[model samples]
Target: MTATLIFLLLFLLGLFLALRPLLGPKEPFPEPPRREELLEELEVLKREVEALEGEEKKLALARMVELERALEGYRPPEPRPFNPLPVALVLGAVVLLGVGLWRYTLPRLPGETTVTARAEARELKALSDKAKKTGAVEDLLAWGRKAFELGVYEQAAEAYMEVLKKDPRNVEAVRRVGILLFLSGRPEEARLFLEIAQHAEPMAAEGWLFLGNLYFQEGRYQEAIAAWERYLEMGGEARERVQGLIAMARAQAQGGKDGKSVYQARCAACHGARGEGGVGPRLQGNPILKAKEAVREIVLQGRGTMPAVPLAPEELSALLDYLDSL
Candidate 1:
């Protein structure tokens, strides 16, 4: 409603500016220099002609005659006929254009009649109605998930909160609320909630992913690496982006090049910064380092969700040395 009012005011203001010059000023059209005044001047000239004699008098009489002839020839200019049709037509067109843009050109807000949006709204309505009648956890969850997908955050929150009230241990509700908190910019609070969700359901890969994001934002590189590793360990699908994130975090953690830095940069994200088990198995006490050739093969030809990570020969040697030390 506020947006509509603002658009309308702007349109009206533009119309006023456009019409102002053509409508002219409010003061009365300056009286057209008065025909009576011209006649009075002619009379004065005639009197002067009578008072004078000879050539001057003849010249004055000629000037008076000229003024009289001018007066005789003068006609008041015709007033412009005011036809309202053109103005009405222009105004009508503006209104039609405005209406057309509002109805069609501009994007409609969600839940306001696009086919997909309407279908989703109907589904949500049915879910909401079912939730209200049954007060069932499943119905509430369905409502919350559907609402969230439609970008109806408030409704999603409401449904999730209801679920939480009924079942405080509901990991789905807890995880989604944590995500909502993260999106709403309360990262500290988001961390607490996401931690709770993670502990509640360790296999929820999305919780671990977001937890990693939160830790990364706080510059906790090791924890971020751990969380993302856990996400991958649990079979999260966004492997490539997470691998990049892990690489960047490791570089930040190890500020210069060396065996340790190379290991951190190349392998820490999946295998853990300290090599405690993560997406990749624990290497801290593993026998894998004894088989360097096999490790090199795996590094060159990625297996499963892991992509091949190319490294310079020197860097690879340093990383292997670092792993042996671990």
Candidate 2:
């Protein structure tokens, strides 16, 4: 409202300036102050000169002639009224320009943020349609990128997941999908995707940041510290925040911890939410729970399709106790 008022004031001001000159006195130049005095004197001399004769008349007549010449020199030109046609044309043009500028070039009616967001929404929809129609990795990536930039996590995840289906090795898709998952509170799934992305592209600072956060949530304090340190080394923007997280993680490392919580954080994502099994075999009532040493060895060393899961002594002990309970 304030912006509209300001624009209106400026528009009115422009019209005022444009019309001011035409509204002024009709004469282009002002009459000189001395010209009126000269004219009055000339009129008086003319009336008196007619009554005179001889030398007196001759002197008076000469004086009258001199006054007439002076009057001629002082004569003001006729004032010309400003032409209405030109004034009207100029006014029409100015009004049209001001209206057009207000509608197009000036600040929008609502707010710039609203205007920009609406534009983004339209572009996001276009990109999403194109991606769905083509099913191409590039198009999907473009859509995902737009959605991610706009903070629409669900749409971003949909697009990136589509890209991953087409190209499993797409690092950006893996990383972005992981970020979306984390934001949606699916930390376990997020961890899997994030791990893949971070390994494929170690230099990505944002990936490391989330990776650190995932580790922190999982009670893997040492790993969290390392990941956050790497993020800082890579020139992450949230230096102070990451440093604080690292300090907190360090504090957590020294504090007492929970075994079930550790297992859920470290193993539940792949194994099972409740040990019923998914990617890895079922651990619930499994014979492996009775063989603690063998399970520990398998966890520490790569076996079959499973990768090594290195853990600090305390976290490893906690995980083992939790696994036995399973």
Candidate 3:
């Protein structure tokens, strides 16, 4: 009931507000003039219009006279002299573009003079032959076994290098060079060639073997073994040889007598008969032997050109005994 009363009040208030503006008081109107007074007013208005018309005629005459004078006396100045600045700016911009082309763009264009493939190859052959004739046997051997496999590593390296000089993309030459490098104790250089060879021929056992041998020379035996094993796994024909080497290395590590004998035969060539130091360090008093286990480790592990010798368990014990006696 209260809610109904409130709504009724709001509606009545809105209606009243809307009607107020229209219902408000209006202003009073002015009284009309008499006919005689209106006629007098008209006469005054007519005189004022006549005076305005006379003034307008005078203004029009004065304006016409001024226009006639201006026409007789006025002359336009000659066209302003031409300026060179616009032309100079355009020429400067063109010159700058030409200079830029000469310095940067032109050199890189397709027809720019460059060494031809044949010329490059000839130069490479010349250099390789020069290197070969210089009696760089080690260098040749280090660079050339993969392509020729001719056993004359020095000659092969020269020939391969010549081929590479001419055509660096020659896969066979690259592989041969890498192998030669590996054999020549230049493993670091060989790595690049081997990697390229491997990429070119992934299944090539020779490349893997060379890479493995390179790893071995670098004292990365585990890597070397892995490479060799990979080669073997791929059905390389030298599987037995690799296995024998691995076995020999294992046997040597175990301190076998056979390992000692192998060491004496092979290592003695440089290291001396009595382990008293020759081209290599003296093994007898080697601080490494102070630790019984260390002696065995060195023998089995081998280092730098020393092949891992395969020795029986008993042979290893005898080898250790012999080393101790030394």
Q: What TM-score would every model get versus the actual structure?
A: 0.51, 0.45, 0.32
Best by TM-score: 1
Residue-level lDDT of model 2, residues 268-296, one tens digit each, is: 88889789998889989999778888888
lDDT of 2: 0.81
Error of 1 at 200 (Å): 3.2
Q: How would you encode candidate 1's per-residue C-alpha lDDT over 1-326 as one tens digit per residue?
A: 45556667767765775576597776676554568888888878866776798998888888887788878888988887887876776677678658744654245446354445445666778888999889999999999998888788888888998999999999999998898888788999899889999997544898999999999888777789999999999989999999999998887756533567767767889989898868988889799779999888778787787789887787778678888888
TM-score of candidate 3 on Cα atoms, chains taken together: 0.32
Model 2 CA deviation exceeding 4 Å by range: 1-113, 257-326
Please state the error at residue 96 of candidate 3 in Å: 85
lDDT of each: 0.81, 0.81, 0.62
Please give the distance, in angstroms, between residue 239's alpha carbon in candidate 3 and its true position after superposition: 2.0
Q: Which ten residues in a row have the lowest lDDT in candidate 3?
A: 105-114
